[model samples]
Target: MKRIGQAMKRMTVLLLAAALTLDPLAAASRQEKALAETKAQLLSHIAVLASDDFEGREPGTDGESKTLRYIGKQFFDLGLVSGTNDPGHPWFAPVTVLGREPATSRATFSRKGKRVFVLQQDVLVYTSGKRALVENAPLVFVGTGKTIPSRADLAGRVALLLEAGIDGSDRQTALIQAGAAGVLTVLDGDHTLENVAGHRQRLGYALGGEELGGDLDAFIAGKALDAALAGTKLSVKALQDRAAAPDFAPLAVDLAVSLEATTRETKIHTHNFIAKLPGKRPAQGAVLLMAHWDHFGTCAQPPAEHLICNGAIDNASGVAVMIEVARRLAKSPQLDRDVYFVATTAEELGLLGAKAFAENPPIPLSRFVAAFNIDSVAIGPAGQAFSIVGQGLTPLDADIAAVAKQQKKKLLMDNRAEAFVRRQDGWELLQHDVPAVMVTSSWGDVTRVEAFLENDYHRPSDVVSPRLELGAAAEDVDFLTALVRWFADPRRVPYRSAAKPG
Candidate 1:
């Protein structure tokens, strides 16, 4: 028994010595250090982009010049070829847009010859380029703003449209194409009058230079609209339900709308920066990654404090993720298909850069197998599932799911997918039949997304905060890096022949 006890003590001492020599915690320490370093790198870029020096990275400002230079320089240093065909320099594709601001606006809604609303309070004309002068134009309720039959005569009338879903832009375009003089969209969801007004006024746009416009577009608050339609033949709810149902006829409201607006237009030239890492088989197709680098610029109306609207999470985080992902892709072995990185400008200006790129792709649109647009990522906890916005828009969800599974993460379908789909740059590409997906980290606490939207969205308060977990963003970077790797593998083809454009 004494010998056995001594032998056991000796074995314990030997085991302790082996552990000391092996440095059992060394690998974990290295991993921790590497993670810390990556977080620092991501935060560094966010700090620079969201800093006052970038001036909110607004399009057509001096901030634009700085932003373009910064992105171009980074791409050049990365040894990426300019995807642009510029003779002098290849990184830039210029997109010209008109920035219009309303000088004076007036609108009135009357029911049965009784005035129901006055401009600047109950009604606001948010869009103005050319003067819109209409006196007592008859109101026609077009169901959900869908395309009207060509035979329908909509000349010299104002169309009351229900709020559309992901296809809102298409519906609005259809309304204009149907020869409606103007369109008034009802507010949707739990939005207040002041909130709606602020949301509308806060929006700035970069309208296509060649785009034709003569119609007025405005939004009416849901509550005020309800009050206006109380005594009418068509209640607001009935109109909404009718618009939603098929075989619904256009209801001629008991009201007419009068509108007038004056505006100032200025031209601004911004660009989308494109860079490419060539693949082993260039003809197969390319995987595209995109991120918008522009922010709100300086506040349109500066408050007493926080003059700059630093869009840290709004986009700087996204751009940083794009850069880091690009770095990883560049370092890896040659992918089966080329990878193109586009850092777009004027995204806040109604996705103008993306629209411009899709209209005239640096490479043929047919060669693009898929596109992943990175925006507003990982503001929540680490290891949360990826929220695939606009999940059913395309078959790309399968690839996202596969990637998520490989990364040991789950996929969270966005409940408000359409709202995000119509708003992001990816949707601009999707309209052209390109398989694109907008990805964000799942909000483990749903309030995180709501809080950001209610408080930080488009505000100066969007700057980086302690609440922003860089560790979560780092996890997103890893996931995206893995996604790109899996997406570009020669053995795998996510696109079916039916899905691929010839």
Candidate 2:
């Protein structure tokens, strides 16, 4: 018995030695040092992007330009092709826009009716300011602001609109292209309504004048609108009649909005950085991994507008994840098809940058297989599994499930309910019929994510460290990295879901 006890002690000592020397299994294929690097990379990138210097990082601002340039420089150094740089440098894809520039002086904005009200309370216009008058500022009240050229007579009329479903469901772009003059827009309330195009993003005050520290036009929500119209002294119908024509003469029905502040009609140019890692097959399909780099640079107001919306968790974290994930793929073996890592801009302005990328894709849109989007890893505790907000609605669900298995995380599909899978750059891809999913957490429903976002989403409170849990984000990075590997190197592209579309 004493001999056996001595043998057991020796076994324990050997086990202790192994424990002291051998490394533990890591969630990621990358080692501790590499993981540390990734974590540090994420933290560092987020810290800078979410820093106060970038303000909210809105596009067209000095901060956004700086941010894009930084990302571009990093991509260039990472062995990626130069996508259109300043002059002669060739880019994989040049960032471009087809929009009017803002003006330096006040704009003359008015509609054809006294009672119709073309003023701020009833109208919202984003002008290039160089032009004093928006030709034919006629007010055609389309029911909800959805359908145009079919349900309503939209040719040669300025649209006075409410949210979708209020009049008819009309696409805003179609209305503008159909030769509608200055548009009059009404607030869509909040997310609770979910009315036609009732996106809460429209409520953001990060407009041109707002961010530039210039006075933005606003209506006092109550008597101000009434007082403006009381001065019109013209009938709504008579004003509408006067407004009808290719070029109608100006009448008393015209109302102009004047904000007492210096305006600049300067041209705004910004770009999104793209890095390509070619794959083996080169033709079957491609999976996109994306994140937005722009944030709320500056507010239309301070203290009240919360100044800078640093957007640490709002996006810098997501962009950092993209960089880390890209680095991993860069080091891995060839994939079946191409994988593109895109860091977008102007996402805060309605996913404009992403939309532009989609409309003019680097590859065939039909060949675009899937999109995996990361947006601010605000929750999702480590060792605790989570779900894709829009799981099972696409082919990616099975892949995510397989990932959950590899991660040992018990995944849930319908946990976030209404919020699941409806946001981030992935959702934009989903709209174009590409299979896509977004992973994020506004800290579950119980947490202060909503309030936090309300107060800090675009505010300086969005800074890194104090605003985020690096450990929690690390777990997400691991799970996501593994999933991306599986996605690009799958034996077969995952099958689409049998479920109906949302």
Candidate 3:
């Protein structure tokens, strides 16, 4: 009996040694298998979402209905409950959107009670409402519109801004906040007035109840400004040169501008798909994952062989990544804080849905531990470095860096991707002091991203194909899974004040 016992112990020891030797290899195999499955899943989701039948997933269309059903079904199948917490529409949160297009617009300029004779074609006037009128508001040249002159009482006055690569939305918002009755952007860059007019002629959308008031937003041709200032000391060229000075201040142009714009408004109803994985400690802060699911529908007119902008890489890939990450997290052990998933609507239309959600959140915005946004995440190949779009703006960078290190992924520490921060859904949340970031390997390769943007982005050519590089996107899914786990752990990432990071 003693001899038999010794032989059995030796056999057990050998088995233990063999198991130890193969564990690393086994783990590696499992990881590779998971990655392959993630890639396949990503492709499957993108194929369905980017299919011609989805009609580019435009909001408030038959395409949007189909998209909502598909995304809701996916969340339901994953055993996630409604994050919106509305029992009547458990899986969806309603977002009312208003679409407006300029029908008729005209602007007139006067100097010393004499008509300046500015051509109507030289200026494009637009409003966020049905009608807007700005009568005889004096024009004050505010240089680049980056700063309002303290001495210049801009109340009820028009602020003329030199277009010097400044963001139009930010410049307009700044001037509006400073009590400017109207804003006019002069076209001084590569973009011609015709190009600007062509782009703005289309229907613009914003969330309901958030429309612009009687304030005027107009763009003027530089020549028109020069014509209005003709025989005066200030010319467009002189004003442009003066704007280059560091101490440039607002200068009163001897012109009074009167403008009237009429818009045709239409109301579109859309919904944001929301699902949640309940955590053990419900009172703890939650982690949110978001991706916009809307794209331009029927972008091309008839006679074009392809008429739809499938948005395969623009956002189908992003939604797929979000879905897969949710799936993986749902299957893992319960997290301490809830993980919420939102597929927002009308992101292509100025992030209307995201704005609505922020304005009226299911949970208090302060309860959100961290938020990560994914967009156009299928451009780069595998092994590309990852970038945080909101890199230096938030305090979540250290935790994100830790996860990247653990995953053996290279993280670009530069804030170059911050240029796109205001262009995505995260910007809306960030405006509300929510900690939001977009971590993607695709944006790390600026060349590939730029090529995609210039060539296929928002065009009919953005379709699903074998050439859609999804390797890095799959890796991002894995990275996000790890990130959510890290953030959802109450013990690791404790709840902090939700103030915007300085």
Candidate 4:
């Protein structure tokens, strides 16, 4: 018996030594396993979401329904509670969207009561609302549409703007706010009149209750403007040249314009899928993680063999990364502040879903410690550098930089990615003064991104194939997981000084 007791003691000591020796290695193995599992999940999600079965995940369609169910199931399976704060429809926040397409448009211009023959094809007028009209409003050249005259000066006048790669919606909104009766953007950049007209001719979408545009928002061909300016002191070239001056201001043109447009509208009901991982101290504010679950449905018309725009890298990859990040965070220790996961709808339709969330948040907008948006994350290889889309626009840069350093990942500190800032869902949140950013490796290499944009972007060819590089995306998942944890620590990330309105 004494011999046996001594032997047992020796075995126990050996076991304790083994555990101590293997602890670090075991932890590393576990981390590697977790990362591998996340990569597998990321691939699986992209495949499923980008498949034809999803029908491109367009809002107000069966595709949307399937997407919502899939994302909701992921959240539920991850043990995330409803972030919507609604008891009935726990996972969704309803958003009403209006889709509009131009039906009929007409415009006429005159000078000194003499008729001006502006070709009908040269002017494209349309509205996202029911109808719009302008009756003999005087034309005021606003130059590049960067600066506008006062409400007093612009009231009851049609503003002629030079399109210079400016965001049309923002410019139109500014003109509208300045009391301009109408806006005519003259083609002044690389975009041809036909391309602009074709884009405007397609269906345009906006939030249901929101105003669409100025009374008569239209695009005018530069040649057409030149023709209208004939026999006058003002010329298209001269006006464009004058626009380059630093002191350029609104100049009145001796032209009277009348325009009318009617649009066909369709109302679509959609929902934003929101879920939450509750934290210990809810008052510390929450961290938001979001990705849009939408793409162009049936982008190709009949006679095309491939009709669906399988948005594998355009955004399915993004949503997959978001989900994998959520999964990793959920398994970690409880955070000091809650973390919310949002799968926004109708992002393809001018970020309508993101706008809806910002306008009517389940939680106060000010309560968000920080919001991180993932988008188009599957473009680069494993070692590619990452960039923040809204780098200098917010105060979260330092913390993000710290995380990147700790993870030993390459981070581009420039604001080059900001070129695409207005094109993503993050822009809507940023407009509402919420600190939102898209940290992605996809945009780090502009060459690759441009190639994807030129070839597969928005095309049926954007599918789950070998060409879709996801190694860097998997790394992004891990990095973003770290970011969520770091930000969710109330001790680490300070609360906002002044909270913005929801």
lDDT of 1 by residue, 145-165 (tens): 655734255678888887753
lDDT score for candidate 3 against the true structure:
0.88
Clashes of 4: 0
Q: Point out where model 2 deviates above 4 Å.
A: 1-38, 53-56, 76-92, 96-266, 300-307, 378-380, 415-417, 420-423, 440-448, 494-502
Candidate 4: Cα lDDT at 95: 95
Please, what are the lDDT tens digits per residue for candidate 4 over residues 3-51?
A: 9999999999999988966899886787677767766888999999999
Arranged by lDDT with the best first, the candidates are 3, 4, 1, 2
User: Residue 68 in model 4: shift from native, Å?
Assistant: 0.9
TM-score, model 1 to reference: 0.74
Best by TM-score: 3
Tell me the whole-model lDDT of each prediction, alpha carbons only: 0.76, 0.57, 0.88, 0.87
Two-way lDDT contest, 3 vs 4, winner? 3
> Candidate 4: minimum summed lDDT over ten consecutive residues — where?
493-502
In terms of lDDT, which candidate is stronger, 1 or 4? Answer: 4
Q: List the residue pairs that clash in candidate 1.
A: none
TM-score for all models, in order of appearance? 0.74, 0.63, 0.85, 0.83
Error of 4 at 344 (Å): 0.6
lDDT, residue 284, candidate 1: 76
Using lDDT as the yardstick, the better of models 2 and 4 is: 4
lDDT of 2 at 336: 78
Worst 10 residues of 1 by lDDT: 493-502
Judged by lDDT, which candidate is best?
3
